[model samples]
Target: MDDDHDDFVGCDTWDEMTAWLGESLPDIPAGVTIDFGPKDLHIGDEPLDDEFDDTDPIEALCAQIVVLKHGRYLVRRSHVVMEATNYLDHDASSATPNLWFDDDPTGDCTAGSIYVDDAGLAAEICVTWLRAESGLPDPTEFGFDISEATHLPGLPGTDAGWSLDDFLRRLGH
Candidate 1:
């Protein structure tokens, strides 16, 4: 993994995540406060999809923010991992952070693992994943950029040298 902590300097905390969502997305319906601390966020009266039926309930929450490099624009999404605790142990936990590119003509989705010392670090880790997945125009040319972005203090080593662009290229993108 990259092991560089510099990229995660400014990230939202649990509370800030809630506030940021309120300020960004349209107001959630009544009784749907941006709280994912206790009960999991359910879609409706229906049970979760069968694919997610075996998923572990979330013990923590994180926020997803999408930023466009060339424009002063950003959008936020808060997602609760229903299987976070399965990867957690006494001193740490792992989260699978996913990025949905709604605007990508090719319908690309990016994701990776993030380790957290505690639940409080979830948002920061999520932000790190976002930066790595944004595909921004930077010195590292997206490929080398993401290849050097993974950094979790207490988790197992990740395939940081892995590059999304290369994967896409191999897949004929």
Candidate 2:
């Protein structure tokens, strides 16, 4: 296995991608969560799958994922795109302190999902997405220093880590 990336073998279908990612990325920390959606079946503009029946045409995609990263929400669609969004609102950087988490890929208010490596990164995204989505701790406390591998405040894994609900309650969310 190469240190740069896990021994991940590419597969054609989203199901294969799902198997590989879930099996390969075992070290994802406790609180982090990564969701994998169904594969898209489309013939040009028409969707061939039932999952997309009610979903918007543009938002429907293959291998969609939503995760938290560094106190913000990051969404990955079609395995090649990672977009940092607030999720609750698709504001698209229309205002100051936009919902994005980083300034690199997300600098222009976006990111590429290919930048995501494995579970370690996934967990960070999980916490980030949760913190923002929960609307807790107040936006005034936005700068809470949660680095990679650092558990959420009060979570069992860290000295100051806390559970998601507890963190929210502490701030009266």
Candidate 3:
């Protein structure tokens, strides 16, 4: 994992976070669909009226990512879709606490969220969520785990994993 902790935290955009996830995780099975958008942005095949425009100056931003697992298995096969989320609490003052991932998108499972500005941590939270929805109870299956109440620190972007620089390069930054 990269020892330069500062460099691996807090991603500023969805593109960057998506790039990091693509580079970090193992090859997903074909036909897997990963839908990422603002929280409460979509419902039942229709987009909500208050969709995020990205230009609107907001106090807080919540990004929801849902992965539809077809017929895969960690311990057993699951037919239901799973969702995870990350939030950037720009409105968080010394007194106001940040928002978290608690909504049950599928109306069945309510996964946790990571309240950090780090992109790596956000990606890690998604990974953890996927695992939890994978029917596997073991957290060590992935290498590390984050506390449910204290959502801090995340999966280490190993030496073999792609870095933010890689995403920047793709963007010609």
Best of the candidates, TM-score: 3
Any runs in candidate 1 off by more than 4 Å, and if so which?
Answer: 1-15, 18-44, 47-81, 92-110, 116-122, 127-173
Ten-residue stretch with the least lDDT total in model 2? 138-147
lDDT of 2 by residue, 86-120 (tens): 33432223433223334443332233232343444
Every model's TM-score:
0.21, 0.22, 0.26
- Candidate 3 matches the true fold with a TM-score of 0.26
Per-residue accuracy of model 1 over 2-76 as CA lDDT, tens digit each: 222112112224344333323332221111111122123343425556566534433223333222112111222
Error of 3 at 119 (Å): 0.7
lDDT for 92 in candidate 1 is 18
Cα shift from native, residue 118, model 3 (Å):
1.0
Q: Write candidate 3's Cα lDDT for 19-72 as tens digits.
A: 555453333221222332222223233332467453433221122332212312
Clashes of 1: 1
Candidate 2, which segments miss by more than 4 Å at Cα?
1-24, 27-114, 137-173
As for lDDT, the candidate ahead, 1 or 2, is: 2
The pairs that clash in candidate 3 are 9-118, 10-117, 10-118, 10-119, 11-119
